[model samples]
Target: MASVNRFIQFNNETINTKMLHQMEMLAGALADAPYLKVTTRQLIEFRPSESSVSVSVFWRHRPKQIERNGYLSDIYLLGAGYWRHFSIRAWTKFKKASTELPNLKEQLLLCAEEFRLIEKISKERPGTADAFSVRESIYRDYHRDRYKQNKQKGFLADAFLNAAFLQLRGEEVPGSDGFKPLFFLWSGIFDAKSTRDCAIVVENMLPRLEYMLEEDMVHSYYTFGEAVENIPPFRYHEGIESEQRDQEEEIETIEEWFQSWHRETEISEAPAMEFELERGDSSYAEGGREEEGTGEIQQTAKGDSRGDHQEDNDAADRQTEKAAKQASGKFGSANNQVVYTEKRIQVQQDQRGNIEDWRRKQAPYVRALLRELKKRMTQRRQDVRHNLNAGRLSRNLLPLVIEERPKPFYRKTAPSKELDAVFCLLIDGSASMIDKLDETKQAVLLFHDVLRGLNVPHDIVMFYEDAYEASDAAQPNYFEWMHKLEDGNRDHAQEIVSMEAHEDNRDGFAIRWMTDRVNKRTEKHRFMLVFSDGEPSAYNYAENGVIDTANAVSEAKKQGIEVLHLFLSSEPTTEEQAAFYRMMYGNKSVSADSLEHFVEQTLRLLKRTLHLVIQSG
Candidate 1:
């Protein structure tokens, strides 16, 4: 017996470009509002690899809707009110919200509930429907200017939810009785599955939440930026008791002990040769037998011999002595003591053959490495000496004060300064880079090589989704990703290069995490590089898609951290791939067709931008 209103089918379309624009509006509104808590910057780029985009979309958000419901919806990270269900008094608040909503959904829901109640009561009264109809007509008088106030207060409570009411005349929906259906309309379309999923969350709550819009505060912001300050030193004199005086003195003593701790003279790990070991002649490795000779002298002359420094030189020295003995004081025989020794001949012949093979196969690579090493030797020496001088390690007192030689003991490698800088890598883990995983990984590896060659202090990272999912291991690459703290070196990227893939999409978390990490680290030269295919959707965020991930790139740029953007998709358009423009904003974005190309381009860009020396190789 519920009083039925006219019905209108719900505009059950998915999110598309218009929806993304609406998100941008919402993000901008929240970012400017200062009352809503938001962590986002601005729109930077967009993507559908193989399809280029000219712009990016961004957002800011709060929990404004529910998650799972009925057979109509699917779960997603970025959507309206996903976390609101986890709050305290959700049922009470939501129900209360139904009475004072600012938009169509709430109004429709509130009307239906009231209609059902009055209709039932009308069954006992002869003219109940007529009486309630008159009351319903004036319901607006009881709820006037409410939704208007929300819009004035900064929430998009009206336009975003255009409403339509319909009353079905025939046999109605199973549990719906004769009540009308309230349809919520939006101007965009998204994927079908996602649209269906979003619908489920709206079905049951729309009727009840209409009234709560007036009570809830959704849009707000907080302050964040670096600013150092001065403040009084903390003192806890009031908490001290009379008996603790001695303990305070003990603490001072400990502090003094720490102050006097040794700063210089740790240990060095570079291997060095202190003394020479004897080497042997080629014949020493072979048997002492020889070829045709008029005498033992001729026989010995035909055999091989090697240098005195050679291992097993003992055999040659011994053989010389034996020959001298046979000559009986012929050590320097003026007679025919032909010095054509067996050992010398053999060594010459073998050395010539070995030289030919090495020259043909291994010389090029060896020479390249040697030249590079020699070019850097001076820099390496200065680096070691300068770093050691600046570090907490004290000067080498042993070289002057301790005249006596110290006993040898086992030593282990000290903590490496080579691992000194903190790195933040932001990767665009979107759909466009799906098949280009190998190339992206190669770019990462090439970066590793460049750093080692220049002795540049650095680390690696990638941005995927809005949040960061680090490499699974201590080291990460395109195939595998890890956020675990690790030192950078020639082999530092091996583990990551062996990884599988970054996830399928973006949520903006990774960029935020990268910014925060760079902000927190002390290294001014720290690097943050982003590799992506460029399609960044504002969906999949923690609080609907309230924060803009792209402009967050701009925010990071302002912080002075070095950011590199590398795009690995041939998809004509990719997300934010302008390197020079990125540099102007404080990041480097590279757009390339393949991984190999990315690697080459990154190397060239890094050397030019960082002013790092390129070794011979």
Candidate 2:
């Protein structure tokens, strides 16, 4: 099936994942919380206990500049304002006290406390004024619009809340005369330096406003504290008591320490097993000890069969130990403790027939692409030098001879220089690719056929992890080689067709693994193309996978390997998805909307890359 590429326009502002990552980092730095993770959620929240912050996705419909400013302001508000200055314990108590109040007054109390925290932080950090200014403007406009709508809809409580927000921001309220006493009471919140003060002001104003406002507000403009209701009042005391118990348990007497050390020494010195050496026919003894003078054990007689057999076993044991150590060497980020194995596909005869059938079906498209690539390569390889003084003689020089300037010799350099490059194709074999597997195989087949046609030494491997069996101690990833560089130009179409969808994809680990292999190649140009349907998903890897993959891509580039990503999807690629892929692969990513588009993109990428290689050569 052919894939169609469609262009669509979206009205809402989309968040760029790369930019979001940067913002998260910035938030972490500003908040002095290095591990803080910022994400987009339905509501804006600040969870200091969890070291995370969430900005609302509701800002997506805002203008691009406003959305960016709003996000930045929210980060500053929660990170710098709330994290450092807001008193969680005090806010928790105030929230508990307000449990019986109407939602409008409760929301107003939270909003007032937030404004006080913002004011405190802004005063301390003068540079945050611009972002706060944008924030203030956005809220003022929002509340003003909502106030008129609420009044028209006969929601007096909501309208009063909105009007109170406008009044606090120093904006004129439509019915300020009627709420003069409430406004006078709300003015005390501006002078509040603490959450308790803000809570008190809301408490005082509620007595007068509660009677006029019959219903609670429909929307919650702010959340003062998240998940604080379940906290025990004596939690701090309990923590101290636990620490005291731990300290008491850690103390030991000198005799006890000595006993522990003695036990460790006894364990280290358990016992040793010795093997007796065999002797020849004329040997004095088979198990000779070391002599006192020479301090050397007697050597076994030459050609002792048992000695040779023992030596062979010892050598095999050493080799096995060395192989095990090498296999255990780690890859990817330090947190990713994964070990991978490489295996050659064991293709069956029936699979070979399927491979041939698939190849036959894709031959026309392959031939067309092959012809185009060959033509481009031929054009690139043509070395033409004009107006040279030496080399091939030109007839135009005869005309210049009359003027005594005969320098029109042209040179045509040899066009047989082969491309000095190598390539690797990494296919994601996760179960999510089941629907796209057929097209993925076609693309791989195209990649294999084209590279083989060019006589380019390349490798094609499908990588996946055993999600069910993965763990922190040892995650087993497998690389099933369809074609390997060591195999030269051997036909592996059958092996390529044997690829099956597996459990999960750990893209960063796979990329780093392949980068290590390709980096060792002697080729002047090394290119690695990765095909995956979505972000990395593996045991304990979802959160850090995207960043780790991006770092892996960067590391490959630093090692002179160009990593390009092809995002395979069964539907049209969304702007958000494209941005996410771009975050990992930078501009080297291409999101294909269909199977045909996948093949087309793969060919286009190869052609473009090869053209550059040819030109560079």
Candidate 3:
């Protein structure tokens, strides 16, 4: 009993496997169908006006809790049956009739298709076919009675019910001439009175239908509307027109809801200054090496020397070769595997005035933050007067006079807070950031001025991929240094103002390179922050870039560097975006809805860090 329970399981995996098998069979069967294509992006969406349709990703997954007990769940079978009977022509006709017919034409079209599919399924999987047919028949009869009670002409609805009954029983129904042909398609396969007939039909048709579908030679059994009645309810077209208007109104309501959710916010920053930095051709220059001076002498000696002399020269040559190999090995060991090249991109001289004006406007904010940081770092000194005064406490000679040894305690001074940290601000210069460049510059300037005031070493860099020039042979990666840690000044503020969005972003490589830079710093605390608007995207980097960056972040964390990310997005983020951020940064990522929020968050982080530093000091 334990083993049996252990072997039994129910979950999405089981559901997906079954559904995937069904889809594969259907796809194989309909390889030649031109009206629709199977997809896993949406649920039962049929756009007859478009080239293909979409199926939901959840189609292959089901809740496990629903499959408890030994009860046989028909959910998977019903879904398979639905797709098995899917006919492009029927869907297209329905799309048209839903707009053209009033009362029951579109419903009739769907009913006819369902019957045809049920007949075909009876020949293959009778159990599934019967189950679906029963459900369809019950709903059909219910609708027919409802329509009759409402005094609506339901002639077509009655025909559909009769057809559904015939498909379910594989028997002729009385007074339904329009559904007789569909019944004949399943004649002699099963009987209405025998459950044994369903079992027998299933056993026989499984092999036959599976093979037939795989060969792609099975003729489509559905006619979509070949057996529909000639006349439907009265005023059918008018009813359909009314239904179409109602559907349109519902769609408009849905669109309004989405629009309300995505209402645009106001922009709060100026446009970035136009830069004059020319894109430089990044190419490796090869240098020539000089030949060894011993070349001629060694050759001549080897040629002229006789027996013993030749052996001596050969031995010397061997020693020289070994020494040369050692030297080359050392040089090779010192060579960098990934050579990173970076330079400061100069701003246009004419734009200096505009840059200065912007900096002045932002000066007050920077100065206030600097003052707060400096105040937090300020230290207090205490003094003590005594015989032996060093720093904080003094010696007590009175105790020595009372026969106790003279004990001296120095008056120690409290040490000032040391900014023992390295900060790396890696900015995404992807083209999507073109609109947010100005605000990004302001944030960068604030970071720079704060760190500069605290005398902390930090590097400001903008990294992006030249999407246009990138190729398999050469991946054009560009990184502009706005400020270097070694420079110790914000004189390069112009570079930040001149920053502009460029092309695609390869975040993984950039993070890795910055990680390497931070790893080299001597500071006890290392911090690297990324500012990006979206996922890591580039011409060949879309799918793998996210994973690669995540791995790189893990590597940074392993090296004791704290990696944080700022999502610089203006619009309300979707679930997909949130999931992506969580995957990339875990709990270390924060989102900013606008430029103002971005500034506020940055200041908050700075103040918190300063407070912590002050407390530690």
- The alpha-carbon lDDT assigned to residue 552 of candidate 2 equals 77
Per-model lDDT = 0.35, 0.70, 0.51
How good is model 3 by TM-score? 0.45
What lDDT does candidate 2 reach at residue 55? 79
How many clashes show up in model 2?
Answer: 0
Error of 1 at 471 (Å): 22
| TM-score (all chains, Cα) for each model | 0.33, 0.64, 0.45
Question: For residues 186-304, could you state the per-residue lDDT of candidate 3 as single tens digits?
Answer: 34343422223332333333333333222221111112222222111232345476656554221122122222222210010111111101212121112212332222222223344
| Candidate topping lDDT | 2
Q: Worst 10-residue stretch by lDDT in candidate 2?
A: 270-279
Report lDDT (Cα) of residue 177, candidate 3: 62
Candidate 3: 10-residue stretch with minimal lDDT: 265-274
- Cα lDDT of model 2 by residue, 1-617, tens digit: 11112245453333455657677788878766555667677667754333357876756777878778888878877777666556555655655654334687667876786688678878888887887788888888888898889889988778878888888888888665777888888999878987678878888877677677666777777654346442212213444765565442221221222233334333322211111123222223443444423323323333434322534433433333221111223354323356566666556567766677877977887788668767766766675777777877786756575756566778765544566899999999888888888789888888998888888899899888888877665677788778777666777787788888988888888888889899788999899999999888777776566666776787789999999999999888977778777878999999898777877888788888977876666
Superior candidate under lDDT, 2 versus 3: 2
For model 1, the superposed segments whose C-alpha errors exceed 4 Å read 1-423, 429-432, 462-485, 488-490, 537-539, 542-547, 574-587, 594-596, 612-617
